[model samples]
Target: MTKQIFKPRGQNTTRAIAANVFSLCFPLFLVDAVRRVHPVALQQFHLLPPDGADLAPGLLEDDPRIVIASAWIDLTDGPVVLHLPHTHGRHFDLTLIDTAGEPFASLGTRTDNDDGVDVAVVGPRWSGEVPHTHLARRAPSDACWAVSRIHAHSPLDRPEAEAVSRNQHVSSLGRRAEHRTDHVTSLEPPAVSSLRQVIELGPAVFFHRLDSVLDRAPIGFERSVRPLIDQFRRDLDGPPPVSSWSPDLAEALELGFADGLAAIRAATAAISESRGIGWHAVAVPQHDESGASLAQAGRAYSSLGAPAREELLTLVCEHDGHGRPLRGDRSSRLRFPPDGLPPVRGFWRLHTRPTASGDKRHGIGDRNDLSPDDDGALSLIIHDLPPAPGDLGNWLSAPHGEMCLIMRLYAPRGEALSGAWRMPPIEIVDLDVDGSRPGGASSESLKPNRRTPS
Candidate 1:
């Protein structure tokens, strides 16, 4: 008998991605997210209240505009019922993602349902009848996540958002169980549980973790690659197992893992930039090819659980209007023409992230306080330090080296989604201490998994 040799896969994402790399790379990040998924009380969301706002700067991507109520659910026990109280017209959305990292379904204001309804989520193996009071939501995997988002515009709307968040909850039918969603706070160090930690587990040890997380039969395009995973596992389980792998085979697997990681970290997926401002406006969870799993896993590591595209269209700006990479050391200005605010039924916000710089400060000021200038143009300045004294509330902050800005439209109108409307861009200006501005490459070296325009 002879051992099978694993063929070498393409290392470049610009070229065709190797099938084997897709199979191995896609599941690695999902297992990372699943490991952190825990249940929270029904209708209760984890957040820092207004008074505790000082502590929020330490958290990663902590958007104060929305309250999150999420949980890790499994159908092996039985079907579960998700309770959603009426929103009373405040924006809210709930997305259901399977263990394979696919977003299967979404519900909320985007779905045209302000009046709340109970949703019964069942797995493929489930054979029970959903009670007439609930809408049946069948999941691809037995293990899934119920991620809910409630609109909260800080100090004013936060109390109401918290109230609405408490009305949304998840309950399992078996054992009449009520799963608990984990409590997330700013006090905990993210490195201890971040998915990035799994990136260095190495192929052999990494595959074992992926195996434990494939709790349900693979579905969708994942089914096509399931055979390869099973064969690899069986090979390892046989007489020699991990020790039996030839050096050539071990090296090939290691390269495949690295290649897949590159694809994920780069977010090499096709991005249609809105007005070429380097803002990626994506309708996520595209399930056309095997790459869907890769995308889902990438989002899990970067975005985690975002609302459905219809309810919220998130635009991320990595570079400036000229397609030049945004630099934190250089100050910039973003000007919106008079009466040109983003049109939305719910609300809009521009979150300026001054990432993990030396000061480690985050966004300051709210989008609500923005007003037009004397000339009828609304200009917001971006800099590492306050542009002016006492007017800090009007400016945006940027990281010391790199820059990122997220613009969100809750309940966006038709024009915003269609090509009819486009957002203004950020232009780098002369604001260094020497008053000299320098321009360089088209992009920065940041490799966050968030998708960006090609």
Candidate 2:
């Protein structure tokens, strides 16, 4: 008996279109994973920091006072242990994220009370006996991402912060623990620069990398989006495009890619809404299936945004509490009473940025410009000019055009992280009539609902 085989050209074209769309969104999760494991840049379980002279080139923005301890782990070999140092009186946080960049566990002053621990991370397929002293956390994929934030109050704080950073250790389950101090490796600038470029590859090449990533990733990770991943792997894993190809198939793939990009933009926009006080807080921890797929794409294209929730809760304020744009044209004051300061064990600092893209402008808390009253309450002035006589030591200079304020509470107390405590508002102050004495602006004017100082 002989069987005849037939091809449905229209059906094949339709499937190809659908596969292209899935391929576009797949990168959102894969890009970060690929970047972390790229042999040219990162090594498994190697600890690296964003030293003053060495910033992750592709990152969108970074703070000068914070040093990041980053490492990428592959549990395929065995469980990897993360050993944190005892940071006395210092605030340090280490966050562990799964392949999807969702933080599943954390360690720090806020989360661990400065007492360090040795935790073991294993892959989903691992079956082994972890030591009783080791806290075992299973990762969703074979690869895990960890970023630790060590607070450096100033240039002087670097040495001590560096010490804490060096104390971090990672050991494969059965091997002797390896401290980061045991080896010295400099940042790979050229490889880091290529991160952004690789993410922008053409569809065919991009999907090829995506397939390689999915192959190594946890199969359960794709279960939710199984159809999408399967179809893409089947239809789009073939050769490059050519003019000789079917016109309808070519057009369909192009349209699918365009539609995928549009879907990602819209998805990111919807969830990117600022949660009052000009902050874009992450309200959703584990994203819905569709959202998770698209948001990863949005963040990948935008540069190194937040890789994970690394114990750092940041709030960006483009407008004052009174609904005025944060601008250099007008002056503003952020006052923190000795009794009502940010509930943090680490510390809190407010810095200004010219626009979202500009470097951070030096400010009060950073430079010791904060001025404290008799009651020890610190009040900082935000303006374009030099410090005024009455200005507290905390003088945050506003940007020339529209500005934004990032109030970062490192090692934040539970109250701050749980939304139980609210950051004080930025009060827009009217500059003195002569514009000579910024000191003339009284702290009393900022006392809410009453003329007298609180």
Assess each prediction's global lDDT (C-alpha) against the native. 0.56, 0.56
Q: Best by TM-score, which number?
A: 2
**Model 2 C-alpha lDDT per residue in residues 1-454, reported as the tens digit of each score:** 1111112266555544543444444443443533444353333334344531222322333465555666777777778888777776566776665655455676667666367777889888889899998778887777766767676766577677777777776778867554547563433534443333443444555555665566544434566454555654466545345534476656666565555556655655655546456455432233233323555545443323243333555666778886777786567777666676777655567777753232234344433545465666666667665344444245565566787787766656778767777667777765443333233445443322212212
Task: After superposing candidate 2 on the true structure, give the runs of residues whose Cα lies further than 4 Å from its correct spot.
Answer: 1-61, 113-115, 177-182, 190-195, 232-248, 275-278, 282-291, 295-310, 321-324, 335-341, 354-379, 411-425, 433-454
Error of 2 at 343 (Å): 4.0
* Ten residues in sequence with the least summed lDDT for candidate 2: 1-10
Scored by lDDT, model 2 comes in at 0.56
Quickly count the clashes in candidate 2.
10
